[model samples]
Target: MGDTLIDEPTDLSVRLATVFSQMTRVRTFRLMNSAERGPWPALLKAVFTTPSLTCLEIWESPWRRPEEKFTIEALELPQNYSSLQRFVYRVPFSDCFPRESKSYGRRDRVQGSVELSNLRVLASLICDSVEVLELPAELAFLLTHITYPKLRVFSVQGHEPLQLAEWAEILRSARQLREVHLQTPIGFTEWSKTSSNWIESNSIPTAPVPQTHSDDLIMRGLSNLESLTISNPLDPGKELFFQFLPYANLRTFSLKAFPPLSALGARWSGIHSQVLTSSEILCILKGIQLINLSTFEVSYSVDAEDGVMLSHISSSFPSLEKLEIHRYRSLAKYNSEYDPLVSMPDALATATNLQHLMLNLDFPERPYWRDDNLNPERYKVFHGFLESQVASPFTGAIPSLKTLGILCHDAFSSYWDTWEVSKTRKLVSRPPHAMSN
Candidate 1:
């Protein structure tokens, strides 16, 4: 028997299938981007037959059309499909043509049906045992028809219109879900009006029956979530984030909010008014206490003024061990008199349990990523400032702190230059090889 590696695209013929079937165990299989679908069915059949397969990753060709269906063709459903614990399908993007648009929905239903059928077959094969599933949001409607009884980690990308009903059904089916990562825009449509009470729309069901009250299911699901991450280029949708709080058993929470277009050389020069104000932060955290939270991260839009919000956060979450205040986009406020190092340590003093902390700041000068011979002097100066002024203060204020990371992004390089704090209160840079972005 010849060794076969299915990492690259191949026209899976009789010889390839024989090679695949003869394999003793296939723990993980990855099919790189392939523009042609001709070889997929044979490859998939061979993969699904492997009872030992635990993870499968497929990236559709970037050149494929958005509506292109991922067909399973005539392949028989594998009895060993339940062995799959992780499945990832990456495509360029997906758009769930909203039912509200009558003309558009009618025209796309034919194209979408092919994708839906393919998904249904895939779901039946693995949804029973998939603990980690990541797919484009357009196919998220699969949750309505299938129950991921063992799903523990669910992630969806792309800004497809997902209704409250769909989200509710997902929560209902994936009862074991512990972590959820949403990298898409989620704005207040109908659910914004009421936090936990959503009335199902009379519009035709996106998927088949087996429905439950979405609002109640959502509330029940959020309470058990241990990690939730939202990275939306548009508004983080304050209401959406807050809805997951107060009742959640969250240990880690991360939110990334993009800076306004004004920051990226747009005509509007004044500071974007969308920055979360101290009052807004207060109202959002008014009756909420994330006592179980050990790790927390947020973008710079989170108020850093006088560090009042930061101070409140530290005080509110007694178990916080790691905290990150980063930026998603370069802010136009680099010229403003707001220096993170000067403002944060004093505020984080109350975080007695915090062990790791990272703060992102604008670089003093633009550095190019392509410049290999970049001057080391700038990094040295920044580290010097952090040790003497920033890390030094943190050592006394947050005695539990063991590391302090300063993140800087330049055109040249972007990474966290971290310092390890010693018992003697000295800050030492962890080796250059240890730095990471």
Candidate 2:
């Protein structure tokens, strides 16, 4: 057992190499240590011997440079690395290559120059920062030469924005490339200025790309894509949505730090009559169903009226199986006029297909007025709405709802307790026809 255990890695490596040789679709090779370089040549021999490897990922620890510091690019890929379909490298930028080395001109060039002829998918290209102003020429050349016809996913993280012409050409070249995630942290402000010109010149009049002005480039290029996620927190306004709204094929969409619904309404005023109405929301829902989207999520900070508008929009998505509504705490001020006990029953009544529902009612735990000391007239109005109107409407409307989650702020625990009293009333008054098994 001891001898067998000692030989396990060798045995495994041999078995992996044998399997790698026969693979035609997918392959992965990972390494951990960089202190010892002697074993790499043998590993490379095993990796290169397989001519059909389509996916490759190499991870190595920092390598000791001649200057005695560890560096990236220490574990250089072997030459003749053909047949690679996707390649990923997750090594620290600070540790890989020397800052002065000309060989490490730009990441794209480094990737493009590799002998991975059949490469199709590239993802998670991590760098210290991304530039959106001046992209490296070598990287641009590499992007132009790399085969993208068969590529399905591509993600780049860096500060530089590839030249506008280069990006246009890339969009034109990568016909089959579908999913793209770009993270550019720098030069966005300057880049935003020329974004309009770039879009006009490219004939893709989408929103001004924030930094790299690549937003339009991305939209134009990934025309056939069905899923898109943009993480730009700087500009989550309606203009961004308008720019990409033409992509009727999108089924799954996500935006981080999106602007308020009112802002969205104001910016698209001309199209508001066409796109922001109930009919438009229904059309988007139909599109989502046609594309087979089962999950939809939208989180933003807006007022109660905006929430109402959003709810109306959500009603259009009849096929949605799971829905998550995240109301920011910042919007709590607008809840001053909204009585939780009354508002919830109506909202719950409308979401008939909801299998799971989460409502984060951002209210203070204790109302300024105690339930005992509450104005008799206001209490009557609130209680009347819950008892006579809200609870009665819920019986037949939410037949399909299985799970309901209610989250409240710590300060609003007392108010929630009062809200629970309303729930008790609901159970007691549940019509015989509304009782679930």
Candidate 3:
């Protein structure tokens, strides 16, 4: 596809119509920045009208703002096109439906809009067939406007806080949803108590939906989830997360501490305290038993008590097969006695069913590589440190363990060295590195 093929040429519409009409077998289409400036009515028409198209992605540059002369596209969608089963639309930096503005005493029209009528038609065509959907939080209104009867996977990334009612409605309508991934903003917001629009639209006079507590609504929505991955800094949201555990039927769960902002204006002192703390993690695994959970990953602040936490996890989830633990801060400043690498293997000794494990930790000491100098002897000592402190201990602790990876990170680079356990009960590096006699 040349730029001229989709760019604003005089015969763009006619050319697109002819070209797309012949693409009868086209199953996926991606419309990006090239189509941001104009509605390209004919191009959109071709996409929605394609009988075999199963996926459609419409995106705009994350940093691109609407131009001064921008006009909202008010094009109508075709009556029916059920072949589309996946849709992804992203406008991370800009609003999807920009509202009208008044500047310099002059009123400006809305920059982007999804008319109600078009949403209705889109629902008829898409809501029934769309099994996977991804959108930015700014366009969450679409969830209320459109009902997804067969949706199974949903993902959303937000630039701001998303209200509770919106979250409830998403799970309410998608009754069969199995997987949900949410990337929330830095700070958490309280879920709103009520939303007249969502309530009245679905409520009936004779038997209105019960006006239960907002927490209950969210709890019911999470009951059927099999896998849930949340990326947040674990602010006030961690309290709400505690409520979700009992109701969720999750088989895979990942809780990542979303990194705090490192921009100049941000405080470096406060940022170090942002990662998940030892107490917070222990609180979660204390009394709760995620029996069905097989795969787990978490990012936490490194401390001496990490080994204790890992032991708790092994006992709590006996069916564990794959596990990954990431240390967000460096161990370079800490003394060797407090090094997690030494105690990690003995800690996870209870996970007898475990087959694979990965640990991402900062180096105990800064390597000379930071100065652009590589010493084979220094690397050998580091390899020996792992063979004795990590690999050798792990080989005897867990009989079922087959593969282990020690990902060491420094200021300069990350090296993921993997060791394969042989039947002779010995650990050998897959890609052998320099070793001392």
Question: RMSD in angstroms, candidate 3?
Answer: 8.1
Cα deviation at 231, candidate 3, in Å, is: 2.1
Model 1 lDDT per residue over 190-289, tens place: 3322211111221236554344455567767776789886654234332544664544488987654322211233221221223344445455555567
Native-vs-model 2 lDDT?
Answer: 0.39
lDDT of each: 0.59, 0.39, 0.58
Which pairs in model 1 have colliding backbones? 367-412, 368-411, 368-412, 369-411, 369-412
- Per-residue lDDT of model 2, residues 1-437, tens digit only: 01112112556557766876776554545454443321233344466456655445543322222222221233233333345566544221222223453322123222222311212112112111111111222233234533345555554433334454545556655667565443332123333333233322323233334645556655667577655544332332323433444455655554322222212212211210111322333333344332344455544444445435455544755555555444444534433445433454455455556554444333443233324454556544544544344334444346655443333222122212122223332424221111000
Query: Could you say which candidate leads in TM-score?
Result: 1
Tell me, what's the RMSD of every candidate?
Answer: 7.5, 14.4, 8.1
Query: Positional deviation of 88 in candidate 3, in angstroms?
Result: 2.5
Number of clashes found in candidate 3: 0
The true-versus-predicted C-alpha distance at residue 30 of model 2, in Å, is: 4.8
Q: What is the TM-score of each candidate against the true structure?
A: 0.73, 0.44, 0.69
Lowest lDDT sum, 10 consecutive residues, model 3, at: 101-110
Clash pairs for candidate 3: none
